[model samples]
Target: KGISADVINIHTIKPLDAEAIIKSVKKTGCVVTAEEHNFLGGLGESVARTLAENNPAPQEFVATQDTFGESGTPEQLFEKYGLNSEAILKAAEKVIKRK
Candidate 1:
């Protein structure tokens, strides 16, 4: 996509791709991390911490908060928790401003 030059996806959590993430942040000066897990211990948090320690880039987290999901369709849960693409875009905009 012309909107983004490169996209890197990681699979592991414990040993996150800190170096690659930092490299991307160094180039973009901002980041938006999306994950299906809770924000507290999710990949977004780890990325935020890494950026804070290395270069301190602004980061948006698109993940569930410290809350549990209810017994409903996945779409229902996503809408209820504001976890859709619109929400992520809004968060990314906000984070970019903060940067």
Candidate 2:
């Protein structure tokens, strides 16, 4: 939480800002993309593809993996679908360690 942050708000999804995302990944050399949707065909995958094609960096996806959502409180849903901070951290670590 104390780390410096440079946030970029992407309001448009139909026409994603691939260049911006690619540039950000190039600068950081790592990325953690989070979304409420499923991992497949989601923003995380889009970011990963962009980075892969442009800069090829360590990218992590924090989203529901090939699963459907359940009706419950936000926290409950996250816990049930493994979309919590711990999962995100684990994904980041995995991506970073990938060869």
Candidate 3:
């Protein structure tokens, strides 16, 4: 496979890197956001908003669904919420299928 991936890190979400997001999504035709926060009103929302305004594409999110949290180690939380590398890979596979 000669596919190239376009990866961008938005460290500050107060002001999303919309230009970079649009540019990358335009090239890849899909997106997968992995965030360690609640899926609602998180980076996923910002990304959805950006795509809604600019270029929309099939997207998958690797984040915890909106719900109560329990005490656990970082690894446990990640494993429970499907935020690990396997989760990202699964999300990528899913989004690519939609494309």
Candidate 4:
């Protein structure tokens, strides 16, 4: 867990900061996109496409798999959907290994 990471907080997906993403990946050589939305058509996908076209790198997505929501507290929901810090850490570790 001693790895250094650059965090980019994108406000919108439509105007996704591809430049920021590319710049970060250029420095880190890998990326982990953590989003509360669906992994299929969310920021992760956009970032993946951007990376794939411009600067490809090892990438991991920490998002809700294409699954329906269930009744639960926020903590439980986040844990079940892999939207927690631990999930991000796991994803980051996985991506770094691929780098």
Q: What is the lDDT of every predicted structure here?
A: 0.79, 0.74, 0.88, 0.93
lDDT value for model 2:
0.74
Q: Which candidate is the best by lDDT?
A: 4
> TM-score of each candidate?
0.83, 0.77, 0.91, 0.95
Off by over 4 Å in 2: 1-8
lDDT by residue (37-70, candidate 4, tens digit) is 9899999999999999999899999999999879
lDDT of 1 by residue, 1-99 (tens): 123423668688788989899888888778888776788978887888888899897778888888976778888888877788778778777777786
Model 1 segments beyond 4 Å from truth? 1-6
- Report the C-alpha lDDT of model 2 over 2-96, residue by residue, as the tens digit: 22323456666658898788777666667877777898998877777777777887777778879766799999988878788788777666765
Error of 1 at 3 (Å): 6.2
- Tell me how far the alpha carbon of residue 2 in candidate 2 is from the true structure, in angstroms, after superposition: 9.6
lDDT (tens digit, per residue) of candidate 3 on 10-69:
898888999999999988999999999899999988999999999989999888999788
The lowest-lDDT stretch of 10 consecutive residues in candidate 4 is: 62-71
TM-score comparison, 2 vs 4, better candidate? 4
Which scores greater on lDDT, model 2 or model 3? 3
